[model samples]
Target: MGRAGDVAVGVVFGGSRVDDGQIAARQFLLELWHRDQQRLARVLLFHRLPITLEEMALQISMARRSRLAFLSALIACWFGASAFTYQLALPGRKLVFPTDHYSHPDFKTEWWYYTGHLTSASGKPYGYQVTFFRFGLRDKQDVKSQPLFTDLYMAHFALSDIAAKKFTFRERIQRGIGDKAGAATDRYLVWNENWRVSGAGNDHRIVVSDRGTALDLNLKSRKAPALHGDNGHSQKGEGEGRASYYYSLTRLQTDGELTVAGKTEKVSGLSWMDHEFGSNQLRDDQVGWDWFSLQLDNNSEVMLYMMRRKDGSIDLHSSGTLIDKNGATKHLTKQDYRIEVRERWKSPKSGAHYPIKWRVAIPSESVELEITPAFAEQELITNRSTRVTYWEGAVQVAGTARGAPIKGKGYVEMTGYAGKLNI
Candidate 1:
């Protein structure tokens, strides 16, 4: 693995330096997180929703009468915390390297997401996603107890077998206590037990195993990191702080071994990586989003998210980034593109309807694409962590760009369809 800087000696939050008080504050925050977990469980049991407990907790604002108290406390622990405790993702912030590839403990939320399309030597096509999320319980400086760790780590790994029309997924959550799980700030290393993404610079390795399925991949960037929306400040809402520092490795050459159905196969393909960190990224009126990451055969990629409002209109702040063959990026605003759902699939497991097919049009760029899922049932019912049921799967793209026919594979993520993704 390539090392960036020294292992930040001690705990650091966001870009802030850490002290003893910060350690105590993080410990206190963990206590809050633990209590909130229990309270959230009670709220879910009391409300008895078809949704996952994690989703129920996030949707606590809509809880029934009996669970209001517990929900309120949980919300307080998250949104009502002292402002001094955490750093907000604001405009004009410069994102630094290697360190930025790791974790930002000072930010309330951060995620490293990897999605790819692969084919076995036998030509069996597949799609996979591996994501690691770090949720700050409290800033180290805000903790009152000297705990060894402060952040909570959660990971999701999924594999999509296209021809078989099957999708398998697994999730894990860890406290990061005693090295059980955590991320490195001085380098690019994030892990939850054995599942991890570690690298130096733009080269990385991803390893995940569950049940009879596994992926051991080496990823090398083929292009520079593409910063989205105003140089990495991707806005989601109308006001300030409703944004995130988002960047994507639009193209990564992937080579690895994948074990599926008890058979291990060597696979090579293209992958995409997105790393984002921010706090207070959404407005109260926003409910959910439809995000697309498309890598076309034309040596170009597009990343777009359409944020939906409670009133059913699309948020104007919803934007995208387009990466050219040479890694040049162009910012795309709401007016630059349009997304239309072509089909909906109802999940028998959750009784929720989700859009399974879509049409994306970027007229200004002469881009129009029809996206279809590798399978209709790629919904992840994350009961272990994040508790929200969302559809995130690999997709096949067929459309025209610049008046030329093009085809490729990509990934699509739909949130707030099963339950409100308050987080």
Candidate 2:
């Protein structure tokens, strides 16, 4: 199948010295069409390509009647390819608040992620994660008359019952059909069915319920959104469009009701929220990444991601950010920090070996930390929704900052361990 896709792409570009934009557009179109030809044709075409049928037929040598049919099909494919170009993530994009928080339909992919630690009045410890993802199925112009097939929405809800040594999760996926599932461009509202995250002016609410478990949380941001890597342009690999407009609300005061097994409890804790959008962020050689979001007891935070390649080496584009107690942020290059794996765990279901413990150090900041998962089995096999298997879990942190003893809690996400990630 992949060989066939390569051949199709080559045929499309064989006649012309196509530039980067044209190559990307044709490749994307071919991928969608190859995946589902019937659905792609119906959902992705509203306008025709500007080429004339007579001119197209003139370029080919065939019988008069057969020439017309061939040209018609060729034109349809070209129109579909040319009309579905998405805006790339590039430098110099000035990200604004509240507005940037909304959905970006021009980009190919976008996600809003939240993770935190909560404690009940009785001192019971818990952890939670909620993430909403939007994947563009067609360009904005092509979807004006057919809004339902414009995008795909997915959501994931997870709870870590630390005391019980149990982890539970649910996932939902839906198309942009009517009000059943959608993300608002005019506000910070995104939903897949009843699971949703909505906000206004830095105050947000998250709600999700399924299989006798639910979470209803209200979050208030304590600091401004921290822009990452060159003012929100986070480069993932070497290239013009291999980056993302990324930012994080590292600290949020969270209070909410968590219900598990028909028992509801009021909880309070600190949370971290990340919002990122991009067209093409990963290269073909890149496999996946290890992402960390740490909120320390000193009211400071750190975010780091290490992109791993197929050759078992870390990509030079891997980087991080440090948010000080005052919410000021500093970007860290690949050389600014070091991470060493300390332990590994093998998942019984997926048979994927994962790094579950690590030692992280930032020498310039006089910081060093040892991170370990609260429990080892917080992996999710989401066959029902995104169909991606990964481990995302709450972790415990203990270390030294500026020669002082400090402890913290955070979340770690490791992907592509089960298999090569398609995105």
Candidate 3:
């Protein structure tokens, strides 16, 4: 037998001739099988292997004499040597701009998030959020069909009417069915129906219209993308691949139009953009996370996330990044900063008790801040899309930076209050 055939035999029969490549492939396939049998079947069937049913039956018959060998050979034949592999987020993988901003289908999960505080021409204040998500269903290499079923696309659009004391949001979910919904691999364009975000270089545009609420905004980065945790590999839990390639455009000059309740007004503000992608992130014991993105008036920014475990302790791998006015970044470990909950809010819809107020202090940076929600009712019950009940809202920042009085606006996201987040 040739080398490929020999490797296949070793993988199926546990032969002594098994090479390192065969062993790795065997482990990967087994892991995939254990995670989701239905997903594995989809992966295998879509690969379109040339093995005929008669050939497969012969192989199965030969292995039937040994039950262990039969199971191994069956998996090996179904998975095939050309089985696709998803890419994992690992250390030292440098991110390249524009290219990295585009869709990364090799990773299992990715998101493009934009949040900002906007002020209208009429002096009315508003907070807006538009997010696009891509969840890989199967690797592109495994698909031989059109209208690629390789990914599922979802989006969320929300507006916080501070004056009206109201929060309105919309959700969308769709398969990559034609051009109706998909993210481009060669460019930075992602959309779900009419809601879309596209850009080139540091300039971007976002548009979303649902019902009478809409946001047509343009964003230009005021700073370069800040790499979080060891050059964009943000660790979440205690294991290999328990991390994500994370970065943020900490400051984006935003301007456009905002329409609410049939009133359209020109708006301008500062925005934050985060793009993260990875194959695996959360561990089974990790319940969820509390994420903060603060933009201070001093032109500096702080991004922190605390991964909460089932045992009610924070994971040591939870870390953050500090961006200075000049676009420089400094990584912060859990021990470097302190976050204390000052108050909580119980959602009337989901009953999730979320920490609505926080006192964040970073002694090394000489920063102390109190974050409070602009309004208490920004929680989203995303049953129509992500099916996740979480609180994502605009917040007011107050306190001191380097002993100088400072204040700003930001967004806080709290998940797992209703239930453990699946992703």
Predicted structure with the largest TM-score when compared to the true one: 1
TM value for model 3: 0.80
On the 0 to 100 scale, the lDDT of residue 205 in model 3 is: 99
**Full-model lDDT, candidate 1:** 0.79
Candidate 3, poorest ten consecutive residues by summed lDDT: 1-10
Worst 10 residues of 2 by lDDT: 1-10
Output the TM-score of candidate 2: 0.81
Candidate 1 structure quality by residue, lDDT tens digits, 1-423: 113222232342322455776546645644554555555555533342223324443666554323534433433433333434667778897777766797777688899999999999899999999999987755433222212234667899999999999888989876554344678766789888789899999999999998889999999999989999988888889887888899999899999999997899999999999999988888888889999999999899999999989888999999998899999999999999999999999999998899899999999889899999988899999876877789899999999998999998899999988777875
Q: What is the C-alpha lDDT of each candidate?
A: 0.79, 0.82, 0.80
Worst 10 residues of 1 by lDDT: 1-10
The order by descending lDDT is 2, 3, 1
Off by over 4 Å in 3: 1-83, 139-148
* Tens-digit per-residue lDDT, 1-423, candidate 2: 012112334333222355676657656654543454343333223222222334334444455426345434543444443456788999999999989998888798999999999998788999999999887755534311222245677789999999998999998876553345677766788887788898997789999999889999999999999999999999999999999999999999999998999888899999999999999999999989999999999999999999999999999999999999999999999899999999999999999999999999999999999999999999999876677899999999999998999999999999999988755
lDDT of 2 at 299: 94
Candidate 3 global CA lDDT score: 0.80
Candidate 2: stretches off by over 4 Å: 1-81, 139-148
TM match of model 1 to true structure = 0.82
Winner by TM-score between candidate 3 and candidate 1? 1
